[model samples]
Target: MTLTHTSTGVLEFESLRDLLRGYAGSPLGMGRIQHLAPSLDRDWIEQQQQLTNEIREFRRVGGRFEFAGLLDISKLVDEACIAGAALETTQIRDLIMVVDRAAEWREIVMTPPAAMKNWSAVPNISEGIADFTAFLREFRNKIQPDGTLEDRASPELARIRREIDKQKRTIQESLRGYLRRLAEGGTLQDELVTIRGERFVIPVKVEQKRRVPGVVHGSSSSGQTVFVEPIETIEQNNDLVRLLDEEQAEVHRILLEMTRRIGENAEAIRNAADVLAELELQFAKARFAEDYSCVPVSLSPARDAASGAD
Candidate 1:
C-alpha cells in the first residue's frame, strides 16, 4: 500500500507527532514519535487502534505505567561487538537500566487488568525480556547510579578499599601527632594538617623547615611557611597511595568483566531494547489518545473518494 501526505496532511501529522512525543518517556520513544506517520495498511492501523483502546481502558481503571532509562545504547552495543572493547561504568549502568525498565514493562503487560488481559496478549511481547533482566541482576550490586563500582562489586575490591581506609586513618593519626609536636615546639605555621599534591603535609615556619626534617612540597606566598610531608609518616602515605592504585585497578577489572558479559548477550540485549522501544511507542500513542480524548475515525466512501481526489 502507498501512503502519501500533502502539505496540510504533513503539518497535521507533525502536530500529532509532537503531541505524542510529549508523552514519550525515553529518547528511543521520542525518536519513534518523530518518525511516526499514517499507515496505508488497514491491518496495521487497526492493530494500533486496538492497542490504544486497551491502554485507554487500562488508564481509566487507574492503571499506572512508568518507563525509565530508555536511552539509545546502540552505539555502545556496537562498540561492545569490537574485540577487547569494554564499556565504561556509566554506559553499563545505563544498559542495565534499560534492561530493568524493559523487564518491568513486560511484567506489567503480562499481568494486565482483567478487562485488558486479552489486549495484552500481543505475540512474543515478552520474548528475551526475562533473559536480559536476569543478565542485569549480576550488576545490581556491583554498579552505583553514579557509574562507580561499589566496594561490594568484588571481594578483592572490598579488601583493597578496606586497606586503603586503614592506611588513610593511620596516616591521619601520625600526621596529627606530628602536628601536635610541631605546635608544642612553636615551629608550626598552622595547626592543621592538609594535603598538597596528593601528599599529606603540615605547614611549618620557613625558618623551622630544618626542624620538621621532611620534603618541602610547597611554600606560602609570603615565604614564611612551607608544606612538609614529615619523614615519619612517609611510609604510611606511600602504602595508602599504593592501596588506592590497587583499588582503581580492581574497579577497572570489574567493569571490564561486566562489559564482557553484556557483550556476550549483545543480540539478546538488542532485541530487548527493540521490544522496549516498541512498548514505549504504543504507550505514548495510548497516552496521546487519553489526553486528547481521541477516537479512531473511519473514512467513509465519500470521504475516501474526496481524499483520493486531493
Candidate 2:
C-alpha cells in the first residue's frame, strides 16, 4: 500500500524529508529531496543505493562535488530566449556564472580521480552541456564583476562615458564658484550643491529665488527653501543628460546582442542544468544518508521486507 500524507507524518517521514533538505546545496537539489517518495521497485532502489554509495566514496577520496553557488537561471534563460530582448546587468551576470560553472564541470567530470573512474553513477555531462566558451570570453571582455560594462564594450559607449566624467568634473569645479556667489548674495539657504530632477541645484530662500536667474525645481519640506538650478549650469547639465542618454542606448544595444547569443543555446543550457541537478541530488542523498545513519533496503519478492525499516 502507498503511504498516505497522514501516514507519512505519523511515521516521521515528513520530518525526515525536512532534515534531508538541509543537506542539499541548491534550490534544485532541495526540490528533489522535497519530492521524494517511498519506492518498492527493486531496480530503482538498487540504483539509488548504488548512486549514494558512489557519492560517499567520491567524497571520501577528497573529491569535491556540489551545487553550492548554482543559481536557478531557467527564468532568465526564458527571457533571454525572447527575440530582440535586452537583459539587465544582474541577469547577464547570472548567465556568466552558469557558463563558468559549466566550464568547471567539463574539466572535472571528464577526468575524475582514479577512485571514481569506474563509477557509472556520475557520467560525462559534456554532451548535454553547450559550448559557451566564445560567449564566456566575450562577456568577460565586455563586462565587469560589479555589474558594469567595460570601457571597450563599445566605442560610442566608452566615448560617451568619458565625456560624461569630464563634464561632471567641470560641473563640480563650476559649482564651487556658483555656490559661493549665491552664498554671498544672501539668497542661499545652504552653501551646498544637490540634484533636483537630475540637474544640479542650490537651495535658496523662497523669497530669494528671484535673486538669481535660475529655474525653480522644487522646495524643501518646510517650503522655506527652494531648489533652483542657476542659469549658468543649465547648458552643462543638458550636455550631461545627452551623454547619459547615449550611454543608455549603447548599453541596450550590447544587451540585445548578448541576449540573442544566449537564446542560441537556450535548450542546451536547460539540459545542462538538469544534468547538474541530478548529480547534486545524488550527493545530497549521500550526505543525508550519512548524517542519519540510513541505508537503502531492498524488499523481498513476497513483499515481506524487514519490519524494522518500515
Candidate 3:
C-alpha cells in the first residue's frame, strides 16, 4: 500500500520499517523492507501472512532457514543484459559467485530436511532456474583467481605468453652479460641491469658511454652515469610488447564470450531472482515476528462502525 511522506512520519512507520530491515540478509532484501507499508488489500495481506506463518511454523518444529551470500545482482545483471557488452574480469568473477550462491540456496530449499513438515507451503524459489553447471565449470577452468586466463584458455594465448617469457629471459641474460663486461673493463658506473624507456639497459659512466654504443634513455640526477637501452635488445623488447598486446586481445575475447552467454541466460536468471526475493522476504518477516512477539490477528469489518475500515 502507498503511504504519503507526511502520513508515514506521523504514524512512526519509519521505526517499524528500520526494525524489519535489520533482518534482511542482503542489499536486495533490505530494499524490500524500505518500501514496506501498511496494506488495505485483503488478498495481498493474507498471502503475505500465510507465507510468514508457514516459515515460523516450520522453524518451531526444528527447521532452519537462513539465506547466505544473497547479493544484489541487479546492477551487475544490468551490465550483462546489454548485447556485446564485455564485463571486466572482476565483474565476471562477482557474477559467477551469484550462480554458485543461487545454486546452493536452491538445493537447500528444494531438498528439505527429513524432520521438516508442511514444506509444500514454502515457495519453490528455484523454479525455472537455468542449469549453469557446465558454464561455471568451464569458466573456472579457463580463468585464474588472479584474473588472468590460464595457458589452456586458448592455444594462441598460450603460444603468445610462452614466447613473451622467452623473450624477457633472453633480454635479461643478455643485459646482465653486457653489464659484467663493462664492469670488468672499468667502464661501468653501477654495473646494474635496469629498465630504461621500457627496454633493458645498464648504467655506464659518461666517459664510457660511447663504448656502450646505445641510445641514451636518461641520465642520473648527479650526471655521473647514463641509462641506455642496448641497441641489440631493441628488437627483442619490441617483440615482447607485441606479444603482450596479443595476450590482452585474446583475454578480452574470452571475457566477451562469457558475457554473451550470460546475456543468453538472462531470462532464467531474472525469473529465479523474482522467486528468491519473495522467498527471502517471507523468511525475514517470520524472524521479525518471532523477535518482536508479533501474532497474526484476523482483520474484519466492525459491526458497529462500518466506515472504520477507512
Candidate 4:
C-alpha cells in the first residue's frame, strides 16, 4: 500500500500493476481460492464459468469490486487449471477473462470515481496515467507461455537484488584491499607481485621454503616450473609471504563457510522470497481491480442538449 513517486515524476502504478500480474500467474496466487473452497467438482466449474461471464459483464458496465474480489480472479484461473475435464478447451477463454478483467481495471484506474479517490489528484495526472498506460500495454504484450517474471516480482525482490549487489561489491572491495596489502611488502616476502587482469593474489609455497641458485628448473604435480634467475627474493620475503598466505587462507575459509551457510538456508530463503512475492502480487491485483472496477465501457450522450451542442 505504500507508494513513493520517483524522480522521473512517475507514480509507481506500472510497477504495482506488473506486480499484480506476477501474483495472478503464480502457483500460490492461483491456488488460494480453489485451495480454500475444497471442491474442484463439476458444480464448481459451472460456477466459475458463470463468474467469468459476470466479471466480463461487470467490465462492460462500470462496476466497483472489493480488493478481495480481484484476488478471486487469479483463484478462478487456478481453479480452471485444476478442473481437468475439457479444461484445455477453455484456455483461450480463461486468458480472455484475465485480459478483460485487466482492461477493466486499467480503465478504472485511468479515471477513478470520486468515492475511490483515496489520494489527492496529481496536478498532472497525465504523466502518472501515461506511465501506467504504457506499463499495461507492455505487460499485455509480454504475457507469454513461459509466464512472465512480472507475475512474481515484488518490491521485496527489488530489495533482495539491491542487497545481493551490495554484498557482492563489499566482497569485491575487500578482495582488492587484501591484494593491495600483499603488494606493499606488507607480508615479509621478497616475492614479486604478479598481476593477471583483475584477479589479485600472491603466490606462496604451501610446503617448506626452498632456495635454488643457478636458475633451478623444477616442476610440481602440474609439471611446469622454471626459473630464469636465482630465487634470492623468496628467502627475503619469506615471512611477508607467509603472512599473505595466512590471510588468503582465512579469506578462503570465510567464503567457503558463507557458501555452506547459504546452501543450508536455501529453503528458508526461497520461502521468504515466495511470501514477499505473493504479497506484492496480491497488492498489484487489488490495486488494479480497484482502479478499473468503476470505469464505464460505453459513454452516453449528454443529458442537456444545449451543453452537448456547446
Candidate 5:
C-alpha cells in the first residue's frame, strides 16, 4: 500500500520517528527512521516480525549485544574512491574500531546461547566477510585509542622515542645544573624550569638576562623576568627537536601504512559496516518494542488495515 504524508498526517509519522530515534544506537539507524512508513506487503512485514521475534527470544534468554564505534564512515569510504586517497589517522583508527566491533558481533551471532540455537530467523550478517579480524589485526597494535600511533608501533618508532627520551633527560640535567649555578649566583628569579615554545627554559631576573647567556623567549607582564633557554643545553634541545621530527615522520609512515591497508580491504570493510548498521537498526526496533510493550508492526491489525486500504 501507498502511505503518504497526507493520509497518515505528517505529525503522526514524525512522532513515531521521534520514538524510534530514542532506541536507535547509531547515526545510521537514527537517520533511517525518518524514512519509515507503513507497509501492506504481508511477506515483507512478516519477515521483519520474524527477525524481531528472534531478537526478543534472544533477549528473553538473557542474551545482550552492545555496538561500538558507530561513526558513519561511508563518506570516508567514498572519498577513498581515488587510486591514492588517504585517510586521516583518526579516521583510520575509527575504521579499525568498527571492523573490530563487527568481528566481535559476528562471533556472538555464530555461537549463540542454547536458547537462540534453534531460532532460525537469527541473522548471520557477518557470514562470507572474509577474515575481517585478520585484516584488522594489522592495525590493532599500531594505533592507540587516542588516535596516535604507539611508540612501539614499529622498531623505528620505538628507537626514535628512546632517543627522544634520552635527549630530554640530558637537556633536563643540563638545565638543572644551570639552575643551580644561577641560584648560587643569586641571578635566578625562580627555581622552576618550565617549557616555552617546546624548549625547556628557566625564568631569570631582567637584570641577570646577560648572566644567563641564552635566548630570551619572552618576559613577564611587568618585564621583571625573562624566560631563557640556557646556551649550555641548546645543542641538546636541538637534538631533541630533531628526534621529535623523526618521531612525527615515523608516526606519519605508520598512519599511512594503516590507511593503505584499509584501502586494500576497503570493500569488505564497507560491507561489514553496512551489516552492522542493519543489525543496529533491527535491534533498535526490537528494543523499542520491548521497552514500550508494543506489538510488532506485522502483527498490528490497525496498521495493516490502514495500509491495506491504499
Candidate 6:
C-alpha cells in the first residue's frame, strides 16, 4: 500500500450570521458581569470614599498647607488599582478587549470572574477610571467655581484652620517625644514594630542549629527571616510595643480631640477646605484675568513708600 496522508484542507463555509451569532455570549446570564460588576464597583466606591475622607481629614488637620497641590483623585485611583484596590467599568472593557484579541485562546483566557477570584490578582485599568470619575466630580463642583473666598464666611474657616495648625504642631511634638522615649527604652518588649530598614531578625540554620541553636521561626514572604526567643526577651520586646501602642492610642485620642475641637468651633473642617479650595480657584482666575504691569500689580496695586521714593 502506498503511504498517503489525506489533508482536510476544505475550509467549511458556515453562515457569517451563525459565526457572529453568539460572539457576545457572556459567562453569566443576560446581566453578564452582574455578580462581579457591583462587587468591583462597590469596592472601588468604598475605597474612594475612604480616601476622600482621609484627604478631607488631612486637610482639616492642616496637611494641605504642608503639601503643594490638592490630592489628585485620578492618580490615587490609578495607584489603588495598581496596588490591587478595586476594579472599574472600563477595566472590564479592557479585560474583554484582551479576551477578544486572544483570537484562538479567547475561551481559555481567564475572565474577570476568574482573575478576581485568584488570590494573586493584580491591579488593572479599572482603578484609573474610578479615580478619573472622582477627579471629574471634584473638579466640576467642589473645586472649580468657588474661586477666592470673601470675608463673608471666613472667620469660622480661619479659626478652624488656625486650630488645625496648632493641633498638627502638637502631634509632631508628641511624635518626637515618642521617638525619644523609644531610643531611651531600647528593644521593644511588648509591642510589634513594623520592622523597617536593616536590623531584621533571622532564623537559625539546620546545620548550624547546634552552634546557633535556636527555634524555627516565622518568615516574611519576602524571605526576610524571623526568630522567637524566650518569653523573658518577649517582655522586653513588648515594652516598646506597649509604649508605642499607648503612643498610638494617645495619637488617636489627640486626633479625636482635634476633630472635636474643630467641631466645637463654628464651621467644620469641610467648610474650611471649601474656603481654601474656593480661594485657590479665585486666585487662579484673578491671575488669569489680570493684565501684566511692570510698575504696579493689577490685583493689589499698592506700592511701598520706600520703593516709590527711590
Highest TM-score model number: 5
Two-way lDDT contest, 1 vs 4, winner: 1
Assess candidate 4 and give its TM-score to the true structure: 0.24
Question: What is the per-residue lDDT of model 2 for residues 220-278, given as tens digits with 9 covering 90 to 100?
Answer: 99989998888888999998888888888889898899888888878877787766666
Q: Which ten residues in a row have the lowest lDDT in candidate 2?
A: 121-130
The better-scoring model by lDDT among 1 and 3 is: 1
The better candidate by lDDT, 1 or 6, is 1
Each model's lDDT comes to: 0.78, 0.79, 0.75, 0.37, 0.77, 0.30
Q: How would you order the candidates by lDDT, starting with the best?
A: 2, 1, 5, 3, 4, 6
lDDT of 4 by residue, 199-301 (tens): 2223434232242222233323643332222233333233344444554444344334333433343343333333323333434444455566633223344
- Which runs of model 5 end up more than 4 angstroms from their true locations? 35-37, 80-85, 128-130, 297-310
What TM-score, over all chains together, does every model reach? 0.87, 0.84, 0.77, 0.24, 0.88, 0.28
lDDT of 1 by residue, 1-310 (tens): 5357685385687787787789998897787677777766776776777666766677788887677557888888888777677789889888888878877767776777776666743434656565455676688888888988888899999999888878877888998887887788899888988888767889999988899887889899998989999999888778877887898788878877887888888887888888777777878877777777778878443345566674
Q: Candidate 4 regions off by >4 Å?
A: 1-241, 290-310
Please give the distance, in angstroms, between residue 68's alpha carbon in candidate 3 and its true position after superposition. Answer: 6.5
lDDT of 1: 0.78
Which is superior by lDDT, 2 or 6?
2
Runs in model 2 deviating more than 4 A are 1-13, 38-43, 124-127, 141-146, 150-152, 296-310
Candidate 1 deviant stretches above 4 angstroms: 5-11, 120-124, 205-210, 219-225, 299-310
- The sequence of per-residue lDDT tens digits that candidate 3 reaches over residues 1-310 is 5667788788898898788788888766777677678766777777788878877876777776555556666677777889889998777775676676666656666676665544654544346455667767767667666766689877887988899889889999988887777788899888678876557778889888998887888999999999878888788878777887888898888888888887877776666665566767887888899998999979895366766678
lDDT of 5 at 103: 85
